[model samples]
Target: MSDNVYQKLMRVQSKLKAPKNQFNKFGNYSYRSCEDILEGLKPLLKEVGAILVINDEVVNIANRFYIKATASFISIDDGEKIISSELAREEEERVKFDLAQLTGSVSSYARKYALNGLFAIDDTKDSDSTNKHDKDNITSLNNENKWTNPKLTDNQIKRLYAIAHSKGVVAEKVKSQVEKQLNKKVEELTKAEYDKVCEAYENIKVANS
Candidate 1:
């Protein structure tokens, strides 16, 4: 791929940061797969003249499988050993790390790493592009999709449950307790706001059904 494209991909990847509790959400988060990291990178891919492709191989270790993502810069020179998807795998927590990396496209934090391996993503768009794919011109398709609505995962829910049950939201301790348990920058959501989000999701489900 062109240096321009590679740079853009790196910028995008660097921006990826995993949430405290990632993936593992029920409802559309699991089945529809909307809040997808790859989907977020669609515009960047088209802009940079690169295509990100993923492949899979099975390992004989029982229920083991390997997934590889290849980011091909269409403009790369033949002799050059351009970035390959094979480099994406990390050993020693190989399964867990690879799985996290592969699914990063769906999770907020992990997507950054995925983009790093796949494209030339630059945060500073002024010098990176050839005036065709400037940052301002690139539309964020991430906002248009249904799955864009992010929610806490099962792990996060459990953490929240534990905090709420253990401390029972004593006046001064709620904030610290939540932050410690959830590992998220938590704020007290007003009952109205919380109810609204829940009701809106419920309405969405009913409408879709």
Candidate 2:
């Protein structure tokens, strides 16, 4: 397949420079945050006629909460896209941090790494490192995941029901939503599908007590 879009992405990857501009006081190291990656990507995206989107979701992997960040770079012309995902585990205990603060911190780190994978920004190296960028010698290729996605775990479904119940929603209504949006029973939904419904439920925006 002639992927001109992939070439455009390579162009962005070779040129998009995200320097570690922020200093970490406690760690005594300079690191770039998610905001820094976005600022660097915005102009290059415009230059290549592409758009980048990053989304975060809370997921349980191995009974621990993780922030799953998925980043996509898409060509405006053909909708061809390159996608990358990175997961950051939430701290088991965060001192002086509320639930929201802890989640936000993990989400930022995950998002930054997701963008890094998409744009080939290596944070391990110093801001100024040798290795002439891959502008001239670029090859086009396709990227994807071939594994069959697993269905939602039992705990996830229960959580969904728990959300609806807490929201004053009826069991029948929850069942109806599962069948209507998914066209199948909740038991048949995949993890990604479950996240779709879970995100929808979460979007309801509960008022903080």
Candidate 3:
């Protein structure tokens, strides 16, 4: 049987190499940004006669906000395509505090995961691991030491604890893990760092469950 566009896309998905080029100070780990994934796909897509498009929507799930992102893979050969959808939660508090930042953050997260699904990438870590939001790179990923980087608020810390307790993990463990890894106090951690703390708890949950 001759290879079709769908099979070509599957081959590209299996071969795509989107490296984790970005670094996270909080977790001391590296992760692939949405941009990194897209950049890596360009030449491969061109080779495979395929194109990738990602779309995002702010949708509600369980009365909470989520970014529903869809990644479409289309082949120039016969126009056959594959689509994948992923959702990333948006914190209501962050939405109220800074809708622009929160939206961009969650959108990138969703889009990254969607693309990951379409391309068969394994992402063991969350978006918080990299702080890589394309639209707000300055506010989140780059300026960890800039005085303008705001620390996690009291409410945000409390929220972390609440989530920890709900998940049957000690809230203090989350804070301590972040603080130890980042070498900063919880109050001194930036908003991005707070997300890393949340990711830590998520890891614990996954490990135990």
Off by over 4 Å in 2: 1-3, 126-209
lDDT scores in order: 0.35, 0.65, 0.66
Better of 1 and 3 by TM-score: 3
Instruction: Write model 1 residue lDDT over 82-152, tens digit each, in one string.
Output: 44333111222222234444344223222332344354333222121111111111111121222121233
Can you tell me which runs of candidate 1 are displaced by over 4 Å?
Answer: 1-5, 14-35, 61-209
Q: Please provide TM-scores, in order, for all candidate models, with all chains considered together.
A: 0.30, 0.56, 0.59
Better of 2 and 3 by lDDT: 3
Candidate 3 lDDT over residue span 103-163, tens digit each: 6776776787678778888764444333434322222211132222334434556768877
Residue 126 lDDT in candidate 2: 39
Ten-residue region with minimum lDDT total, candidate 1: 130-139
Question: Model 1, residue 62: displacement in angstroms?
Answer: 8.0
TM-score of 3: 0.59
Give me candidate 1's TM-score against the actual structure: 0.30
Model 2, position 186: C-alpha lDDT score:
86
RMSD of each: 15.0, 17.8, 13.2
